[model samples]
Target: MSVTSRTRFVNPRLGTYFGIFVSSLLGLLMLLLIFEELGTAEPLLRWAMLLGPIILYAAIGLSAPTREPIEFFAAGRRVPAGYTGLGIGVAAMGATGIVAITGVFFLIGYDALCLMIGGLAGFVIMTVMLAPFFRKFGSFTVPSYLGRRFESRPVRLLAAGLMAVPALLMLAAELRVGAAAGGWLTGEGQGVVILLMVATFVVTAVLGGMRSLTWAGSAEAIAAVLALLVPVTIVAVMVTNFPLPQLTNGPLLRALMHSEAAQGLPIIDAPALQFALPGEGMAHIAKRFTAPFGAIGPMAFVVTILTVLTGVAASPWLIPRVTMTPGVYETRKSLGWATVYFGLIMLTCAAVAVYMRDFVMDIVKAGVPSSLPEWMQRLVDLGFVAIDSAAPLNYLSFAFDRDSVLLSLPVAAGLPAVFLYFAAAGIVAAALVGVSATASAIGNVIAEDVVNGFSWEPLPRDGRLHVARIAMAGIAVAGGAVALVAPTDPLRLLLWSLALAGSTFFPVLVLSIWWKRMNDFGAIAGMASGFAVAVLTILAGEANILGIDGALASILGLPAGTLGAVLASIATPQPSRSVLELVREIRIPGGEVIYDREMRLLRLKSRERSS
Candidate 1:
């Protein structure tokens, strides 16, 4: 690629434009928030803040050129490494993970850190074990790769089937998250908020498919980073007299632990002291709070980390990102960016979790809701912040919603109201980016692996675009409807989704790349066993028949997949020489399919060479 071509195709200027645009828009939104604080917020402006960014991102998505199949499916395989990494990092984090992990960290304690650790490890696994080889094979998604590698329709079908549950559930959950975040700004119900978010997905997916989503996701990552970092930095300066929370949190933590109520409340002896928290890790609390793996035992911790690693590798939409990069070197480099981006966010979440835990608790100890400001009252009305004047433990038992932490952080901490606006915007962007990626992945999988596989009848280029858009729209609406009652906890849903992905896809992809002898029968057996065990275990546990918990559910499936594939491969017929030869070319890079009509000629040459 020449310098001009690289600039045109791979090196987009959107990153700089995104920063300028979001900063200005955020300033306007913050002005609205400040006016609202003074009781002068215009309904039109509030609606704009809630819906405007979504519309703008949708427009950006539409602007991408997508008249071609490659544009629609793979973003023309020209996305620069930096953008791809940013997209992956942002997409991997859902609204639930954003809110819940931080909330859990502060609200519960150290267990949240385990997820933070595991999350970073996941990118490393993807980079080293999976990233380079897949791009060389040149497929858009993991399921597509499975179909070709195994040379079996059923194998692809199985992979697609496993994909549906997580993709749909995650999209639905994110829609709810977007709705809830919008509710913070608009004071609307989850259902009403979802309508706007769902519409955004529809318009964008229909406009340019993956080409648009790639840029949009990169923008969202930028928005999320700014929103998170600014607040945490401000809070750190205010509390600890420093700006960097990650480094300056130790003194703040001690202050939070030592800070006490001006007046005491009568206490009842509950399982854990409900009245005046003596700081979970403070001297008086049960077993010092320095525990690395909260609630989950060490075994569960191992399982959780391994599952995250496997799940990251199995990620369908994320894998497509690698395929779109300019080359193996770029793909590898993108993973580094992904790791750095992911770490920055994860670290911010941990700092915010610790900071917010103290922030919320201190507020509670200081006679919440009643003594709180107007912003707290608004939050109370929205149900994220509530105070029971009649509670037994003074304000100690006051309800503080964990999932609302990210959205409510600015307001709860008494920072400038604009932080709230930017935080809400970031929340919407993160949720939408994640949902659109999954929706796009599902649509592409159906279009290529299932619909196109039915007949050698190559799907017309336009037909692929049409079906993919319809598939995405259907998923968005269906997911929105499901979001009405979807679990309030996005992390719980995320955990199961990752488990399912790790169990079914990761083992197969690994074996296919490393062990060339693995045949279709082995791949099918591996996937089925893993999928069956993981799904059944989760189902049984959910229905209350089995004593199984979700913490390590993926652990039960990983071995099943590996063993099934290995044992079944030994029992089944070996893969033919032609398939092995193609695998060899795939293992090495640089096979040019010279012409559309000459693919068969290349296959014949491979067979002849094998013979």
Candidate 2:
């Protein structure tokens, strides 16, 4: 009956209590937002709801046991499987990814599933090829491991440079998504919102680094999952009297199919499509909603999947989830758990996509202008939905921005006022997770690879941590600045990140791990030659390279990179004996450190002196 005993009895699990408290807080906020619907600045309410989840996540991140380099960079390498899985899942799906991927189904058809499957394939690649090796090799950052293993400083610097492209681009894209959500909810300018969001992200990210992300990621997973589920659940219940869209979407799908038959809607060549062209009285192709390869052909379909898997496998941010685990075995086990979490998001994305398509067309089929929601009007104002003189909504189609599909869903479905606000808030939080993680990765590479590499004066522990913090801040600020000046397409930016990762890093990483004879020249040749080809291919395709289009754009990079690597390795001299010996030890799994030449020599001297 002592105070300590009483305290333990009263709070059996702080986590459960914390969950109950957060849920109650969110409920109260939702009710308050609902009550304030009687004429006021909605952004003020939006800012509150959005900041609620974010602030909590930031607090959680800051609470990590991070004081040393190991804790700061790898979260003491003790992250649990559950949270790691959730963090990886949320980071992979990304905020822009959610909107963009779901839009793919509506804009195209079953073809969208390829990206989802391909993304999942990346995890499979990691499990079989990369994750175990990284966990076994044991390093804080990708570049660090590569530089040490290859005994090449240039390799580390160049690796950091290659990853920076997608990491920085993705960070800018996520901020832009956040700005859009903020602007929509708060009625603030996107530019102004970008500044605020950058501050918010830095506050959340600067705390505890990798350690903070471990816990914050779980909370973020919940917010993002809810954001997707709430609308789909509501819409499913409304249309089919079922809460789970995946199980009960048959009727909803049928309704969409029936609606598609009746309309002369414009056909969208989905893969490269910008806006659904409002054609001048052309016969609409009665394309099936479940049609195969909607805009892209067979070759492109194959290429898209390969590219996504490669991209997913290659993403620098994602690999660390494995590196942060306690052991190599745990890293493998965690990937399985991570795959399950990823599968959940993939399922939700697929389900929500069909529902969005169904919801839009059903509204069209009813031919009821009065039933048209205010969000539809918003879409029209934003030019996503076009109007005609005779019809209520002349047509609704994408105009470059695919995010409009998700943005307009709440309004198009006419959910409760508060539900709409919550939906947007969830998306904003999801995007925040992606950008924060990207910023951290970009910062880590700069600090760990480029800055930390300068051994002119080895930094103290405090100096190293300080450099890391400054790098995080600098990357976040730079990404925000980029967002303001030249905001790129969310989906395209994401693809570029994935494509660059896959083509440039994927081949080199795979060869480096499994092939022992792979020398520095071979590694350099593979990454550089392959990266140049991949980037050029992407640019050429984007520029309609020789007027060729479709899946033809994808097959060149990985193969060329692989071939370049293999051939160069054959032509180059074998690595030094010390390098080969190190490679053998890297394949093992354990918590013990394997000493290098310097450490071994010092140990030998100490033993001799003792004797």
Q: Each candidate: what lDDT?
A: 0.71, 0.70
Model 1 whole-model lDDT (C-alpha atoms) = 0.71
Give the TM-score (vs. native) of candidate 1. 0.87
The alpha-carbon lDDT assigned to residue 141 of candidate 2 equals 69
lDDT string for model 2 (6-64, tens) is 11222235378458645954685566556677655565667777777767777766666
- CA RMSD, predictions in order: 5.5, 5.6
Q: Which residue pairs show collisions in model 2?
A: 43-186, 300-551
The C-alpha local distance difference test score for the whole of candidate 2 amounts to 0.70
Clash count in backbone of candidate 1: 0
